[model samples]
Target: MQNHTIYIRTLKRAEHTVFCVEDGQKTYYDPQFKRMLPYASGQQVKRSLLDSFCDAGNIKISPTTFYWDFNKKKELKEGEAFGTCDPTYPDQLIGGWMKASKGGGSRTLKRRSPLSVSAMKPLHPLLAGVNKDSASFDRSGHSHNKIIVRGEDGKELNEDEINTILEGKDRSLTRKWIPASNKATGLFIQDIAIDLRRLFSIRLDDFEPEISQEVEEKLRESGWVEGENVFGRCLIAPVKLREKLIPILAYAIINWKITSNQARTFSLMETLAVSIGGNANKIAGAIRAKLSEENSEQAIPVVEEQVKGIDTFVTPTAAGYVATTTESIEAMDDAEEKLIEILSSYAYEALPEFAL
Candidate 1:
């Protein structure tokens, strides 16, 4: 709600007042979006422009975001201020280059900054119901506003069609975590209908506090004092980064299936443990003990012969995470139906309202 609600775009000398953008580039300039050059209606300007703007496409187009600032061409005295909002201000300015594509594009609210609006809180349409006072301007209203939009993805939208999405007319849904491959171009990975249910029930502000806390803890735990905050959020400490390489060598052995190597046994165990979300030391210890237990009989060798490494399966760029091997991802996908079936059974078990 604190981003890009009201904008003040700069205007060229004689450009048309209204127009629709295509993937960041303005095209077929018109009256709906752009108001009369120096004089125009803000409401008519919004409606007409939005009508042609949204629809028939996917993925949000980086818009020729509208601004209201008019540069004073009149000669200014030495100490005169041109205007409260100037074209020079970063928020109001748009570069000469950059295309604005048209269509049904996503305008996902990614990040937000602490910006203040007078009584008017410039916000997303989804925010209208939450604060209607300053947002709604009737008879005795002061109409000062501003908006800042950034995302050069160059997709356009048609507001007429967008209304259906906001209106809840299309109430049917897609599942949560539907995967990147299944999503439509402009559609987010999670289906909106499903995801909104979570939003309605969750406190969004606290959703990611652990992300920052964990990264800081990992940094301090590593005993690296300098640049601690700098690299706090990375998965692993910067100094211990090379230690992650130990897993790749261990990974090589797994793919080759050289289970007899006793020295690398701990490494292999540690590597797999990390894969399944366990600490390295705990995994190494568990692997050694498990191997020893299975080898109690003479027929069962202490060396694990069946443990084959799938190297070509994945390419590891960093140590902390495994970029899924096409082979592994494929194998997982093959069994995904069963995996989801199992997961779906347990999905609601631990969820809130289970007792109710």
Candidate 2:
């Protein structure tokens, strides 16, 4: 039988420890509680310890399955390391042709799942000339838009509550793209959730790998310089590299979008549709489709027209790849969808996964 393990996380320091038993017992002695406690799989256990542990919050425990490898060895400073038998990593024979030659690198095994597309937050390029405030203006570039998030009780939220809602308990779930209108003193704030989904639609799969690699090398070389301050070890880069690299970076993003596997997740596909559309009217249609109760039909066209004004300031062509326009994104034809799916598979190849 496979082994199951439990992890106890201290509330105070948020430190975690692992525990396993020889028998398949459901209970264990908790050092914090100094007593035995019942536990179940997938449930969180929280309890207070003795006075010595007062500095921390109640101890929390979660049960999880453990994978291990007995045959392979790993290098560790203090002791020998071991591999994991997690399903995320599946071992397999090398290709049949390579097996005949006994190629050293022929046999391979899956190591982990790819990272979530959202995990590439740092890599997502900032849109050109589209500052936070630009999201608020009508198509004419007038500041007339905002996003309102109401509480469960339908009451307006205070700044703190708004922050809490936007930056939820799980920070990863929080929205990454924030528009300027959200900072204003009105009901409208940036709709980050929608923004994140829209990001999936920008088609970057066709971006030339060689060009991207060259751009990265050039940016790293030119963007960094040694400087002197309190110490001689300071390095400098712009707070926003958008101004310097926006032309190339934005072009890359406009061409990248979610792939087929990603589209399998219906919500992701819809978000890509809206983001690619880049038109408020189209996005509102997506919103209406996703959330039938809400109607964004009126507000969307205004925002769409507003963004069109920026066409003069931010022309997307850079490198040889042309920028994806709202109309192009909105097309959602069979060919486009197929291309997005294929590209998505390529993108997923670049991420790592873990078993939970």
- Give one digit per residue, the lDDT tens place, for model 1 in 20-96: 22221122222432311112223223322222222211213233444333348764434212211211111211111
- Model 2: per-residue lDDT, tens digit, 1-356? 11111111100000011111122223434463243332222211101111111222121222233334344465333322223222111110000000111243322222121111121110001110111222222333335535456788998777677677767454332224434321101001111111211111111222211112343344347553333322122223332332222222222222322121211112111112223232334433222112123542212211122233111111111111213343342332432343233233322112223357
* Regions more than 4 Å wrong, model 1: 1-68, 73-356
- Once fitted onto the true fold, the runs of candidate 2 whose alpha carbons sit more than 4 angstroms away are 1-223, 228-234, 237-247, 262-302, 307-356
Give the alpha-carbon lDDT of every model.
0.21, 0.23
TM-score of 2: 0.18
For each candidate, what TM-score against the reference? 0.16, 0.18
Cα-lDDT of candidate 2: 0.23
Cα displacement (Å) at residue 200, model 2: 23
The best candidate by lDDT is 2
